[model samples]
Target: MPIIELRTEIKASKEIVFDLSRSIDLHKISTEHTNETAIAGKTSGLIGIDESVTWRAKHFGIYQLLTSKITEFERPNLFVDEMVKGAFKGFRHEHHFEDLNGGTLMTDYFDYESPFGILGKLADKLFLLKYMTDLLAERNRIVKDFAETDKWKKIVA
Candidate 1:
């Protein structure tokens, strides 16, 4: 398994940042470059504990569909989503938010294992890890940008 952790500081309340992070609409916007779309289950609103979403996106020049469920959720603090079905062997992504001085510190912990055994490990080491990391970073950048500005209202309201 490979784990990727990222931290971002955004000038916004933890509540706001937390809500924005779970917004299905915001995710679609953030991943627009990948043509990501929510195709089923809680496709448009804030996703809560036990809720699931099916996403379709273009990655590695191929279209893939991934479905994940929110296994744990604590408002304005933490949430965990695990893959129900996807390309990878398995994956779990945890989102954490902490209040700071006039802002919030958002952290992402993504753990995943690829299929194909040894060959998958090689792919992870060679390029998959970096690719996934970059995707997460880009998503966080979009979240930070929205949370720090008034643009969040468009998606969350």
Candidate 2:
């Protein structure tokens, strides 16, 4: 099991940050390099509790399909999405938001278990961990970019 935690500061309201974070359209934008897209289940708009999305993307020179469901949600505060079906053995991503200096402090806690047991552990030690971390960081950067500017309106408004 591996856990990756990240905290990002955004000069915007929690509502805006929260909504932007859950916006499926924004996710597709952030992962454009991988050609990620929602192929089914709440393909557009902000996803709420109990909603699921199936994504198709190319990662590590291979194309994979992943389906995740929002199992928990608290408006403008927190949400949890767990992988129901994916390449990974199992994974859970929690999105948390807090108020700071009239802005929002967004935190991501991603925990995942890779497949193939020991081989997966070795891969994590070798490169998988960093690869996943960088991916999350870049995703957060894109979220921040939208949250800090008026650009968020195009997607979340």
Candidate 3:
């Protein structure tokens, strides 16, 4: 398994950051390069506890579908989503938010394992890890841009 931990400081309230992080609409916008879309289940707005979303996206010149279910939720504090069905052997993403001097400190914990055993490990080491990390960084950049500006209202309101 490969684990990725990322932290971003956003100049916004924890509530705003938390909600924006789970917004399907915002995700679509952030991943426009990949042509990501929510194809089923909670396709819009904030995803709450136990809700699942099926996403279709183009990655590495290939189209893939992934479904994830929110397994844990604690409002503006924390949430966890795990893969229900996807191309991976297993995957889990945890989002955490905390108020820090009037701003929000957002953290992401991403864990994933690819299929095909040894070949998967090689792929991860060769390029998949960097690719996934870049995707997450891009997503966070979009979240930060929205949270620090008025653009968030368009998605969250």
| lDDT (Cα, tens digit) per residue for candidate 2, span 1-157 | 9999999999999999999999999999999999999999999999999999999999999999999999999999999999999999999999999999999999999999999999999999999999999989999999999999999999988
Best by lDDT: 2
Clashes of each: 0, 0, 0
Go through the candidates in order and give each one's C-alpha lDDT: 0.95, 0.96, 0.96
lDDT of 1 by residue, 1-157 (tens): 9999999999999999999999999999889999999999989989999999999999999999999999999998999999999999999999999988889999999999999999999999999999999999999999999988899999887
**TM-score per model over all chains:** 0.98, 0.99, 0.98
Report the lDDT of model 2 for residue 82. Answer: 99
Rank candidates by TM-score, best first. Answer: 2, 3, 1
Give the per-residue lDDT digits (tens) of candidate 3, residues 16-109.
Answer: 9999999999999989999999999999999999999999999989999999999999998999999999999999999999999889999999
Off-target runs (Cα >4 Å) in candidate 2 are none
Model 3, 150: alpha-carbon shift in Å?
0.4
Off by over 4 Å in 3: none
Error of 2 at 102 (Å): 1.2
The alpha-carbon lDDT assigned to residue 11 of candidate 1 equals 93
